[model samples]
Target: MSISTVAKKLPTTAIAATVIVLGIGAVAPVAQATVLTFDDIAPISYFNEIPNGYGGFNWNNFNYINGSSPKVRRTGEDNGRVSGDYVAFNGFGNPALVSDSVFDFNSAYLSATWNNGLSVTVEGLKNGATLYSKTVIVDTTQPTLVNFDYFGVDELKFTSFGGVEPNYLGGTGTQFALDNFTFNEKATSIPEPTLLPALFAVGTLSIGSVLRRKQLNQS
Candidate 1:
């Protein structure tokens, strides 16, 4: 094609490239799921604090219970363990938190420690903004399987409320058990769809201009 003809078509070519880039940007990446069983955390005495970086997250007010401990019957620590002898619980009957990069909260098993019909509120957050929140009730004898399916969250905060206090248990509070916590990791900071087209337009136009100049020089 003539140089002038190519020059006239350069913008059109760039626009076409921009369309392709925008299409790719519009497509989100497939996420891979991860399950945190909390069984990997070993227990010290009857329970141990879930340290920072457990299952790629920062944990607060969480501890792993040793079901085999002598206090299991009195404390009801073994009632909720699904995968192993250990299950996580909120320490001091306070709110608990697990945080990391963006991820989807899929599901988990929940149970009450010293009470029945315990109310638990779980909130998903990103950048200090709440994205998802749900309250669930669990039993002391059996665990409730809760499917959250919350997406694109960086933090999961849990708070417990009123429940029937059991006089049999040595300790009593709003504590709940957590096991088999599942989630899907999300790619962070993807290019905005609106910005993709402009970036691709500049790149495509620069490459086209270079090719056009080379052809003119050869002629």
Candidate 2:
């Protein structure tokens, strides 16, 4: 083939090769899923403070009280208490009370961001005829293998005016201690094998173009 014909084909072949490599990288296999259990919460380094009791004490504090609200009072004074109908301790450090029996948990939130396939399950008490639960999908990068995936919940409102006192709660005035918690990451799906066909097509087109250019130069 003429020098000009060969030169033109060179750039096109290089471009095609680059495209194939990039496309394959984009469809690479996903990494393994990570599992974070209640024991993981013990480090205390991974969590952030969230408001839990009256007087603005928060969940990390030892003890406090809430008169008008269904407060999340720590079971024992000085952080001794550890279990109760309305506690949420993840086997880490101190627990906090969720003051105001009929209050709403609209402000509570997770400190860290999670990946697309990560799953977080919070196991807590639903006392005072008022249940509590929250699950959120945190936004993070692909390959959910990173540690400390955090999320938040809101609108945990409660009602106990009827004095029903759900079993989850120790009863009005009775403090509840947080016991356990767990977090886990669901596996990410791998890329499909069908994509191979498209890759092959791209490679074939590149080689065909190079041959066609050579033939034209000879003609």
Model number with the top lDDT: 1
Q: What shift in Å separates residue 138 of candidate 1 from its native position after superposition?
A: 0.7
Q: Rate the local accuracy (lDDT) of all candidates.
A: 0.82, 0.31
Consecutive 10-residue window with the lowest summed lDDT within model 2? 154-163
Question: For residues 115-200, what per-residue lDDT tens digits would candidate 2 score against the true structure?
Answer: 12223333224343324443433212111122222222221221111112333434332222222222222235455434345445
Count steric clashes of candidate 1. 0
Against the true structure, what is each candidate's TM-score?
0.71, 0.26
lDDT of 1 by residue, 1-219 (tens): 554454455566665676585663465667678888877775476788998998889999998888767787644467887887888999978999999998889999999988887899999999999999999998788778999989889999999988887777766788898988998878654655664446545656678889999999999
Error of 1 at 152 (Å): 0.5
